[model samples]
Target: MANTKKDILTILGISIKPGESKEVNFDVANLHTSTPVNVPVIIERSKKPGPTVLFTAGIHGDEVNGVEIVRQIIAKGINKPKCGTTICIPVINVFGFINLKREFPDGRDLNRVFPGSSNGSLASRVAHKLIHEIIPHVDYIMDFHTGGSGRFNAPQIRIVEGERELNDLAKVFGAPFVLYSKHLNKSFRNTCAKLGKVMLLFEGGKSFHIDDLITNSGVNGVKRVLNHLDMLSSKFKVSVPKKDCILIKKSKWKRAKYSGMFKASATISSKVLKGDILGNITDPYGKFNYFVKADNSGYIINVNEAPIVYQGDALFHISTKLED
Candidate 1:
């Protein structure tokens, strides 16, 4: 017979026997004030043996939607594991999180420094620890994210490249849409793919703010994925046939033409044709106005929610398809 205890206690480098949940902390950085910051990880092991699934959020400190999603999932409770374990890391960037910023204090984007070296910059060291220690023990990984500050994104799963299995998994997660995205070098998803792991990126809402709709969608999506993996019992039935996801072979960012107050005529997820008027940038006196237009036909996946903008700042992101 196997042990059936649900909650166990342990720290990093120490392993508890099967059938328990343990909280572990990995040291990320030490502040000038002598306070050490750590990444908190929760490991939930099932009574029955199975595959280990890792759920990570807040890689960008400002992205709160993912953090909330992970929290809600853990709060709901996991019963008997159908197969193995579930590891949840709610926040990955402790430093950035503390400051409510997206990048590290050194101004480095942590997501772009993946699979890093131990003896590198602060961000690189943190990335290295995640890549080397946490990622290796997991089978499947889900990294949650949101649009950066002042931007809004529709709830979507970004499946890297054309991996059919990942696409299927994203569909199961039941986001409004799945974005078939090309993987970027040094991204967490790309690093995992290189290691032969299936990774799904969930992006939604705006950073540092809580949108209930996006949060609920994300919570339900994670649960759906767990059910699909047979890690959780399936009790709820999906109401709609899975939506056919749009394949974003490539994406383009529309930048502000000039510094001023801005207004957008459309929201994220809206479809537009080439030369369609999207918004306008106007000076304080309204004397100078610049119109922003879509350059091609595509769906808007990201839009600036803030009304103010500076010249050359990204205002919208559209994904387009090329003619054969």
Candidate 2:
């Protein structure tokens, strides 16, 4: 499996009143020249009281599908939802975002340091600021992501194993599949869960590029989850049909055997049986090619398209559910 409702929203020293909405830019960091960097947040309080849902995107900076998904949500307006408040932070790592990198300029992955120390590295400080100000107030969170550069991901929801409610929400998301994964230490997903908060991570498309196929599906999934949880007054047209959501317990990644160009035989979401040739890795001149066979039957959730590759480079991500 892979992985919201509303509340009174307050952050950046601003307190939002019930039945109202406000957008605030939070000053969290500074430049060497004393320039201030701000995180943009939109808080909409429902007329009726309920749980709060935190929608976070751009944590990796390069991943923009989440950014677009959140942007459209704010643009479309889910104000005065049936209950609770929707707090949207379209971009968290402002530094990485402008740099188009996943880590801070000082070189730290923000996602790896959670409930961060107040007086730590730049990444830690930023993580601390966000966790202290945001995570505690929310009942549930949706962290968005996309494949790293040069990789394409099949739209899917990944959640930590064994949370019944979270599992249900993942289904409501209606992605092509659901992946149950173990939590990464200090990651937003793990930290939130450690604090007893329910969260989901949505991964799709490729980083940096705007893949509308992922963006649209993400928007609809978020809305569908909101409606399913009774946080929204309306139901969204779930992009993927309910019947299409396949639940998977595990996945495997296939790596390139030799440095060369990769010609893939399977696209994202295409299923293949074990021993099938998922792709071929060959030299630039096509002098010789090695068949990258499928180790397990499953859908090809991710693939690399870069013309050049180094040995051991991940060429495919297989999402599989083994036979019972």
Candidate 3:
């Protein structure tokens, strides 16, 4: 038998031995206000060898709950591990985070740019770097997110339905719901899936703020997965019993027919029957209003919290029919 210790290092060439942590800065962009923006990475390696799991957050900068969740997990410390590595990238979109916006500085969605080109736009370059430098090294990945700004969502896990291994991992993540979403064009999850790595997307709360309940649920979810993988020593006692989750195969956004002050009778996580009143669109004054209702029987997975809206703005995202 041999006792082998693991050596942790960054893409920048800094060394991090077992029981040690370090921040690795990735160059994003250099501007008048600041030099190359850094993507902070927290690495925790165990003396024993195991699979590496990357926990990422802030892919859509305004989504802050996942950032808090990752921060808390790192703060708790990995006292010991049965095997492997856990790398935490709490903020992937540095520019979006600082501007409090959802997309990159160039107004591109980071999530939509994957396996990107090095000679392309800033967002593309970042995506390329991540794919080349990070994705290949990890066995498992958990990309954390929340609803975009002005929308609220129930805590849930998003995965492809037939990916049994991923679905099982989603259960270990313990979100209230697990959405069965197909691969989208150029999305990160799709890219990772193509590479044979099981990636789970945990979504909850809303952008730019922390919801303690959602945050706690996310942190526990990570631990539960780690325990399942035998990376952590302690067994994770699920604090909250798993809630019934609707498996959403397809979702449609209800866009605003006319722009005006909006009022909603339904909230996030509300279940609505066909023709049920969801809300009303009205002029700033008390007169001239139109009702918004569900066209199908389903669960309200996402709702716009912002009162102001424009024509064609997405108002509600519904998951048609529920899954037992």
Candidate 4:
């Protein structure tokens, strides 16, 4: 007979046996008002042990779309995996989520304070707890994100370009594009890489709001990934992105030439050529209007949403990988 006994998975002092789904609260810190803040976690362990996958969101409290994506997956179709385990943390920064901000109450960027220390600041301590306690157990990770304040991003996956494993997973995630960006200092992505876990980041829509297109793509992407890992039921048909996902190796931002009221001429996913007028910053009194033209031909992945802009403000994130 085969050995059915599997290694126990414990998080926040709570043990989840195989074929179990547990919802638990992980106490991280307290507010100035003495309100206890906790990270809500959901774990699903399969009867057949395999890879442990982590799905995290809400590192920035104001980014609500990611939270919705998690809810979509759980409420719509995702159940216990057929093999391995799945852990989902819809909100990681409870303090920031409470205040609708990106940073912790102590004004620290939670995403930038990874590998946290137990004896450090609130963000640092939370990071420490996550890095040491949660991350070490997971073999794969997907951290969801969205456009920052006053910015908007098309549904996309951002991964470290040269990492084949992660890049392959990103392709399986299947967004409009696979974007390569510089790794941030002390970010969870960097920390996970150092620990030898395959992690990728997904971005879509804008902060504080939801777009059906972006949200649907996100939920479907997660399902596809699970299917690829053979964690889903055989009866389930995997999904693909609405369009072919382009691989963007090189991208640049077009900046405003003059400080004024800004307007965009092209939206996300639109293809533009060199010298295309993407947007303009006009003088308040309408005396002068400056056109922000693309320096090179590319696809628009992100667009600035703010009405006002200063010279050199980034207006569009364009990828040179166009055609097909």
Candidate 5:
């Protein structure tokens, strides 16, 4: 990716010069009560010009882990880069966030509508405004997310296969696992890719919950990336990852075979062999118990955490192939 350095950064119709700080409102609409909502876009620039990176989270309102990750980045002053610019948007779906839900007020997933039209649904309009007003100002993006309800994900980075630059950056971020995944149509990642913007999507923990381990993983990954770009402040130190990142090329979900109360014995990021006892599903009456086994030999990337599950619900996500 080329450096999108500018002497003057203009975002949301606000002009911020080098070495300036500004909090611009990214709010596109008001609440039902006619009250104004504040979806802040925090931008910090260094005196020296370099690359501009955006840190975004809360695309899904219930993904509090992602929101906490970005919150820590801003709280610790990490967003104040030593060079270039850093823009942080801790919550994108303000409607969902306010209601503690995942979709907009009209029940549309914001992630599904990208590059939206000016006269569209509330979610689509938000997407349209973000793509037009915010995306063009940054060269790189790190969007944080979490697994949907009841599934706990090990800290990982997701990117499309065969993109050398993205692969290298993912390595620099140094998460535990790097999953080679495809871009969904009309998603933020796809829209950014189409517009020639490089993005690294970070997924960790589970929705509606915040774990310190997950938060640290995300915050540390941001530091590593900033350090790699030579934008890290001298006050912060980047730590080397304890283990090498596992590059997963293919994976499959192991679903429950029976409806019952479930408990996972295998932990996230643990290596499991074929037919290993991953967890157990037990009937409410305790009359029967079914043990769930691994389908293949690989690392466990995601584990379902819901206490009660139905047959065919995904129990675990296991890696089937890895890159050498």
Candidate 6:
């Protein structure tokens, strides 16, 4: 991760000196009812100067699991670093959050618009503000997310392949898995990369659901990263990850063969061999039962948790390759 040093930090025109804290509003626009929405940006600085880290979540409104993780980081005072600055934006897409929807009110996916125009759509303006105002002052970013809908993902840190700095930081984050993925076009990660910012995108759990295990993984991983940077407070103790972090080079999704009620017997992050029974699809009248088998021997990273499925719906995401 990159590090920037300065005696004073100014964000959104607010000048914050060392050992100061402030809550600034990332004001985008008001609701349809003319209510002013407050997207609070919590900033904490230590007496000593160090790197500036930005922690953000809820870019996709329904990804409450990610929001919970950031909330815990702030609630537990983990954002109060012993050195440097910590900025927390627990809910970036507050518009979507209020409506319990995934996209902006204008039906735009916030993550798809990056380095946005100031006079574009609502989502674009928000994106433009974030990239132009907040990102410039930050050296490192940790954005949190979860599976879109029914698919439950194991805790993992995702980064583009072949970057030693990202790989080293991902290892320090200490998540259960580190998946090498390419950056999506116009994504926040891609924009940050273009701006020479180091970011670790965290994915886990499912949208609109909060899992304690997943929450702990994210919070702990943040602590580990802060500790590695020598910014963690002395009051908190960092725990070693329970398992070795697996590096996945390639993966494949197992789709359903028959359209029926589905149930997964295989759990996330478990290893399975070819031809192993992973789950089953059954008819409503109990007239038929079809067992879903693994096509290859690999680790299961994501399992669809929805009760119903179509024939082509994805059932399980399994790793097909690993990094040595």
Better of 5 and 6 by TM-score: 5
lDDT of 1: 0.80
Worst 10 residues of 4 by lDDT: 1-10
TM-score, one value per model:
0.88, 0.93, 0.89, 0.94, 0.98, 0.98
- Stretches of candidate 2 off by over 4 Å are 1-9, 235-242, 322-324
Better of 2 and 3 by TM-score: 2
Per-residue alpha-carbon lDDT of candidate 4 for residues 31-115, written as tens digits (9 for 90 to 100): 7888777677889888897888888899998999999998777776474688888888889988898889989988999988888
The runs of at least 3 residues in candidate 6 whose Cα sits more than 4 Å from the true structure, single-residue gaps closed, are 1-6
Per model, how many backbone clashes are there?
A: 4, 16, 1, 1, 0, 0
Which has the higher TM-score value, candidate number 2 or candidate number 4?
4
Q: Across residues 1-324, which tens digit of lDDT does each residue of candidate 2 receive? A: 111223345677887877888888866669767888878788887777777888989989898777888888888875346777778999988889988998988898999988788899888988888888777778878888999968998888998777899888998888887888899899888888888888889999888888888988788888888887687766444345646587778788888888887788788888888999888888867588888899888888888877778899998988766313
Clashing pairs in 4: 116-128
Q: Estimate every model's Cα lDDT from 0 to 1.
A: 0.80, 0.81, 0.80, 0.84, 0.94, 0.94
Candidates sorted by TM-score, descending order? 5, 6, 4, 2, 3, 1
- Model 1 residue 57 distance off true place after TM-score fit, in angstroms: 1.1
Pairs of residues at least 3 apart in sequence or in different chains that clash in candidate 1: 8-21, 49-83, 50-83, 50-84
lDDT for model 2, please. 0.81
TM-score of 3: 0.89
The predicted structure with the larger TM-score, 2 or 6, is 6
Error of 6 at 121 (Å): 0.6
Model 6 / residue 293 / CA error / Å: 0.8
Q: Give per-residue CA lDDT, model 3, range 1-324, as digits (tens).
A: 011336554554666676555677767677547766778777767767777888999888899888889888877764235577777888988788888888988899988999888999888988888887777767889988998857887888899878789878887777777888888989999898888888999988888779988888788888778888888766445355457445777778888999999877888877788899899999988887999988888788888888888889888888865555
Lowest lDDT block of 10, candidate 3:
1-10
Kindly report which residue stretches of model 1 are placed more than 4 angstroms away from their true locations once superposed. 1-11, 78-80, 234-243, 322-324
RMSD list, candidates in order:
3.6, 3.1, 3.1, 2.6, 1.0, 1.2
Clashes of 2: 16
Candidate 3: which pairs clash?
Answer: 50-84
